[model samples]
Target: MTETTPAQLIARSNRLGADPKNTNYAGGNTSAKGTEIDPVTGTPVELLWVKGSGGDLGTLQESGLAVLRLDRMRALVDVYPGLEREDEMVAAFDYCLHGKGGAAPSIDTAMHGLVDAAHVDHLHPDSGIAIATAVDGEALTSRIFGDKVVWVPWRRPGFQLGLDIAQIKAANPQAVGCILGGHGITAWGETSEESEANSLWIIDTAQAYIDEHGVDEPFGAVRPGYEPLPVDARLERAAALAPTIRGIASTDSPMVGHFTDSEEVLEFLASEKAPALAALGTSCPDHFLRTKVKPLILDLPATASVEEQIARLHELHAEYRADYQAYYEAHATAESPAIRGADPLIVLIPGVGMFSYGANKQTARVAGEFYVNAINVMRGAEALSSYQPISDAEKFRIEYWALEEAKLQRMPKPKSHQGRIAFVTGAASGIGKAIATRLAAEGACVIVADLDLEKAAAAAAELGGPDVAVGVAANVADAAAVQQALNDAVLSFGGVDLVVNNAGLSLSKPLLETTEQDWDLQHDVMAKGSFLVSKAAAKVLIEQRLGGDIVYISSKNSVFAGPNNIAYSATKADQAHQVRLLAVELGEHGIRVNGINPDGVVRGSGIFASGWGANRAATYGVKEEDLGQFYANRTILKREVVPENVADAVYVLTGPELSRTTGLHIPVDSGVAAAFLR
Candidate 1:
């Protein structure tokens, strides 16, 4: 048989990890044993390559594997201080490093190393977990796979658990794997192909059994009046309540949110047993780690007014916080890590759907997905028998595990705009796009709102796909369009925390040459449009009760008395004052309003490229090509300003550095004396 290599192991891991039915995001571990010449001794030595801590299987890379000397790894069993000191074994793995180990070893490293197989897979597939969590799991395992698979009783994953599995494998010579009681499954094979095939067989067989013998309605009958709201109404309600839920979830720390009203979620929410099941919480450690101990479920029916639902949400959130604090107190010991946060990570609304929160968008979205997996597990478990998760004490042990705490502590500090959602008008190109890109780089989820839907979508994709950005079309001058844009933002990222008013068209003309159409067009999009967008965003921001930012990308023309720029100048001036007015009016609600005045952003400016560049050049007696330089020469700083320059000013004004400064304008025209705020 050809020996499995690291590359092949990665391929196998990706195949299994990519499928949700096999395992969840960042939830499983895979390993391969091989022999390589030792760098120091120039002799062949066996090594175990296992997925590292916090690495996801689907995207696993060679660098994400922890390589340990097989001899040293197995030798630790002799010195193992028993289950009481199992955690210390994780640190001891460092001593077993084959070389400069690729990545930090995960706690499950022992499980893979101690198992006497060329390949091993420990997975948390929903189907496998369903049977593992069933009250009659041991009996069911015997009935389903017979002698081919065995069952291991509940035990915290550590060195002892590894020894037990190794012993089980040795004793049951014909057994290919075992169902981990109250956990998941572990499978092994002499080769990588066999390992992957065995894992799949177990998962597929378990699912087949559940499907054939399971009850018709695992979640119970749909409750009256608790049916899903109409599609539009459901979204509208989710948008209305998302901000408040996000705010409540952010009590301990700022968080980004994700909303899901998928068919499965709706069905579960409408089920008679949903309340009881949700309260019992998720069974898998991976599920609860991301979702929290359990979700905070809104008891109100779909018929309840959004206002009533929101009120109930607050009460439920308070109760969840209190209950979480009690859970921590009940199980915490002197050595346990301090309670991380009392705020619930997942919130379930009977009619609307689910809202999951995390420090960022991907995490938030994945948490929601994991909860769905939990839902699946419950459905299958209930159908097979009774769903029984590990005890609270066991869950508490894992949640506050020292190793897990270290992992959290190792996370990088958040970027300045982390957990913020920004809606940027005209974001398909030029200055707006630059601002959106900059904000996204600083960890903000961006809503790229533009008049052109295709261009907006392309730009959003370029920024980082749906997780970091989404595109929405809006004619900001229209109140309905503006409101819809804000609604899209709320649905996309829970709420809008920052608003950038930058969509405008320029038609440079003398006061006599400027027609009524030009004046109205410029004013409607820039002046009134800013007002419409701000008004709509304010509702969400106020509902969230989270202080936010509103920035106007007013031009230097707002202040500079440039010639033949009457209509454009008027709208800029309007936008400038609107910033000040809204700053004062919205300050009570903690919304900061600011403005940026930029000149000669001609190179990449959509306004300039669209005829304004040539028109401005003719007015100044310079070639259109030299227009940017001409504007720069006239400025105090002689350096031509670009869209990125304006973007930098936007970041500074709205970032933590200017947290205390508002109702201000920061000039970004390379020190334009005329544009300076006096």
Candidate 2:
């Protein structure tokens, strides 16, 4: 095997997956031919180890390698004549598997098995595809690489294509690799190192040719000062556009919108030729599975007001959907699957850059990343020559392939809160962060809104990446700030499914000692803050026509007034009454407003850290260390109430289990008799 081991094969495959220029996420495959001891025969049998179906080359593992009997696989070529159907050919390949531990063999296993080399690699490199998918691709390939490379015209990846590749390789013994017109390139050698070297050489060679001969265009129009616009300004605009896009992009499944403004995205958007360039299809045909044939483009003026922009976006979105439906109807066949949803996955805005739409944040961000790389490659191709991608017919075949459709339909059921977005005020730390993490664990994308922007970012990072949890800074008490925070959530995550009004501060002063500022602070956050968030979120939920939740985190003091805590107790009482009123007003719209009363959640809570625990202990003539036990003893259940206890209650209220229950108070205080709902 020329010193090529399984570990080396895996390393090389991972290297290919890790580089976006070489492979787009899970788009490529690699294989190695070796021998393994057969369990039945106890003899060394020839085998082919190919990357498993749906596996990413960047994070490949040995276990991810599908082992197939080489002799049996080779024999399929002879029997393949009668198997005209793709499924029949696929079945024969599956029958050739040697074991059941690994994943299914890659879809390109037939092509890999036909190559008479120890190591084989098929990669969708950006530079190579730019030339391969061009109008004069075959001629350009001959002129650029000459004898070193062979050319294969476009064909669906199946038995026929594999047979063609095998025949071409046999005919061109001097060739090191072959470029599949409008697809990608394949490289093979006696060793993994040699195969990888050949692939790199081909990519580098193509890139160098473009660097030398491609027409370089001045990328984007620059302002007088050349300094980019403030990030906050872009974010503001992106937020304003989020709800409109979300409303327009709704389909069979809810889609989360992720906004991105990377340097590449900005530069591409700023170019004078952006609209024409964007009209060209994806650089690689496989990207159709992620981004579709092309993105929906919009021209967003810098001077447009939020309302005006949203109105324009809504109108454009309707037109985009109509166009998508027309495209579907034009090419659909009897055997083709039902028309897929009309929502465009990628939306490009001139000033706002790009927004990738998906069922959740992870998928959205992945689409964004793919488009960024696509933009870079297409820019180079545009400067060099016309960026000619595959036709709509080819895209339709790949996008709705029966095998892919079946696989996608059989995908595991999503979690309870999949595609759901949640907003949690004061989520930077303590009870808010705990609740946010809990929501994410159940598959909800959470917006961590906090007064301290830095802390909010840190908390979001701690929970997960920006895709799972995003941070927005705002004073919940400020009306304008609350509205902005609501906008932030919608923009970052498309829409809000659950809103947690958990932002509160403790003021533990006697009635005579309490100042006007302290009273206003407590009321502003607990009562006014909850009102503003609920009002804005309710509007969004109504527009979405999807049922949603509004959860108010009230204190036990709302029921039984505590000594020297008039501001905290009175504000919490107001919050409880507001929840009932909101529940009455919003119930008609299918938006549930509920309240959770948690008592003495002293452990790891923001109020505890802000001296509430010490103040309570001092008032009760006990040390702070004994505060938790003191509260525990006071409750009938005699269990100390923690943040998670409150979070669990929130989950129940927000989830479908309690869907029929609204306008009610749920106690999460280990059975506090005085705080019990009467």
Candidate 3:
């Protein structure tokens, strides 16, 4: 065994994945260290680190590792001899994974300790996964590797896997390391040189076997699932998992194009009548944190609801967790707690795969690099044989490890929205301002549109710098002006997925005293403006083939019909009526329509100030300050209807949290029951 040179390491690392560009989740993790850098807060995290669970080990680093006290680990193992209860096992692993005890070893620590050698490395390399999990994996693998590496039956990782390897070691005290059946390979050496060489040789041989069989490339990888998070912070989260550098994320990060399966795979799937399932981040032992327990397979067509999708993902995770819990309950001591919260089941979205966080630049680069290559390998070998994963029972034991759960808890950023956009009409102040600010905070590029150009400009300035929020000047009621804003949105940010239509004016007058001019003034801005904005969104959303979300700022008076405000009430209904029809027409195009029926907004700082509210209260025998609050607190929930309430509703509509319901109007009237309590 010889020593590996740095140049040799770098060259090998570059070849570890596709999109060797220093980006997270582009294709997969890079094996290179220290390439990711934080774009915001301008702080640098680790550059090189060990890859997460089942990550492309080809792109690994020392910092990414969950360094643990090996002595402490052995102590925990002794206490729980059976370690069978899934929850108990998970609790143990989570506690240990945090390795907060100065030596937080990886969840795979035990296996690394057992099967690993002077230089030990394991990976669920794409090529190996395909042949190993196939119908004829045993025969195919046997035919390819011949006598180079020994093969054993599939077994769960940890003590049992360690035992299996130990047995193999026992039989041939001097024999080379063995590969786990239906899983991945572990290359060990007397020295790092021998280990890396063995690993490369196995990878090459596996690639040759796959190429000979003419398997197609990995197809239909869709990362559609998104969790809302801060844009700059998301970039920072990406940076932390790296070895040395940081990452500069953009609005474009969420705009990755979708990829469907090839004709061959599509045909195969249709004929079999089975929904397509993806093997997440290498499967089994790597299943817990990085890619979760399962990948988000779209079941051939797209899953309908975001909530439903989230439900399905959680259900799958719950099933895996339950099965784990049952196993431990049945087999081990009853005192252990479940490790890692339910949140740790981080499933990779079908279209949007897993991302990276490393200690140094090299580590992050390598993690992304490795995933890109591994995914390709998984796809390429599909035609040759199916990549069936290890049984769930075995997967639970490894996943529930206390050490692994601990590592997950410390993840810098666990949620993000990658491919969505938002717009806020009258985004200069109050409700509109709040809505735009919230969406931008959660990683959506907000187009702050207002007729008052100066106000919009000032609002954008407050958001600081370019990208998070951009001010657009246009009158929502004017067809041409509305269109120019739409065009600007398309050109500047690809397309819009979210719009909070908050541009409107309010007035107070008795119904008998109302005239044509006051009525038109209200209708032109609120009702017509809402329709024009929706109209523009429909065309762009349909063209882009991406779904859209629209949030109308309808007033609570639309339903409640408060005293002395007939025109405001009428226009609010008109604006909301447009949303229902809009839903019918745009549903097929993937656009959702929703509205917020906000009540008595006292901070009415948009186009029209709350001067109307103050005057109305004086005329109605109440204090100006008490009118808004008085009306709001009369509700069942007894909460004040503030700008924040309206803003929250808009935020929910424009994000993945409410991606399922369209054409639905939510009342931000502090939970007032629609009917009176007689």
**Weakest 10 consecutive residues of candidate 3 by summed lDDT:** 242-251
Residue pair clashes in candidate 2: none
Q: What is the lDDT of residue 230 in candidate 1?
A: 94
Q: For model 3, how does the per-residue alpha-carbon lDDT over 542-580 read when each residue is reduced to its tens digit? A: 655556787788876777656788898899889878888
User: Cα RMSD for candidate 3?
Assistant: 13.8
lDDT of 1 by residue, 289-367 (tens): 9998899999999999989988998999889999999999999999999889999899998878999998889999999
* Tens digit of per-residue lDDT, candidate 2, span 1-678: 433567888999988788788888787899988877788989888888899888889999988888888999999977776435755677677789887737777568888999888888998888888777767888878988998899899876777778788888888888888889778899888888899999999998988988888876725453232223468877777776676667666655677778888888877776776777777768575676778778887765555576776777777777878887887888889999997798788888666668887878978878887787678667656656666777888778778788778878978888878888999998888788889999999989999999999999988898887889989997977888888888878777877889999998887889999999999988888888888888888878876667789999998889986798999999999999988998999999788999999999888888887888888899888999999999999999999999888889888898879889899888888888887778
Ranked by TM-score from best down, the candidates are 1, 2, 3
Model 1 bad stretches (over 4 Å): 1-4
RMSD (CA, Å), each prediction? 1.2, 3.2, 13.8
| Candidate 3 accuracy as TM-score | 0.47
lDDT (0-100) at residue 646 of candidate 1? 87
> Candidate 3's C-alpha lDDT?
0.55
